[model samples]
Target: MTVALMWEARAVEGRGADLLAWVRQQPLADEPLRRDVLRAPQDRVLVITWWDAPYDADLPELPEPDAELVTRAVHRWRFEALPEH
Candidate 1:
């Protein structure tokens, strides 16, 4: 299994119930959902996803503003993950 570290940051101009509705509609649109998203207060969100197959997670193929957010989100950092010992 493989896991991808995803991240996103959005401006404060648009924050509403519509945002939630839009996000929900998107998960199963073009591809099956395989992600976990975490929010940082009101301006930033991070996502981590797992794949059973090899994937190149470029976001240009997704929705406009969201794809742009993913493209610039930056996903090349490394960190230690503690395993159960």
Candidate 2:
């Protein structure tokens, strides 16, 4: 099964671009099968990475950007792909 890691964070006021740039420059320890970057109206940035591993596998995650760039701590979630019926 494959697992997907969802990481999200909100930038400080007027710092959304900076936060996005930082995330774009990050280097992943392991190459993911796919990745997507998303943004929201409220300066929210979401990065989703698909990996070829179990949901419970120990995977390398993106490190948090500088605290000054974000409004709150980063949030993360993991989900495993379900088999086709």
* Candidate closest to the true structure, highest TM-score: 2
Give the true-structure RMSD of model 1.
5.5
Where is model 2 poorest over a 10-residue stretch in terms of lDDT?
A: 53-62
Identify the runs in model 1 with alpha carbons over 4 angstroms from their true place: 14-20, 29-33, 55-62, 66-85
**Could you tell me the TM-score of candidate 2?**
0.94
What does candidate 1's lDDT look like per residue over 1-85, in tens digits? 3434343445344452334444445553334236665565554545454444335443312243454333244334322234479
lDDT tens readout by residue for model 2, 1-85: 8999999999998898988989999999889999899999778999999999977899989898889899999999999989989
Name the lDDT of candidate 2: 0.92
Clashes of each: 0, 0
How does candidate 1 fare on TM-score?
Answer: 0.45
lDDT of 1: 0.43
Q: lDDT of each structure?
A: 0.43, 0.92
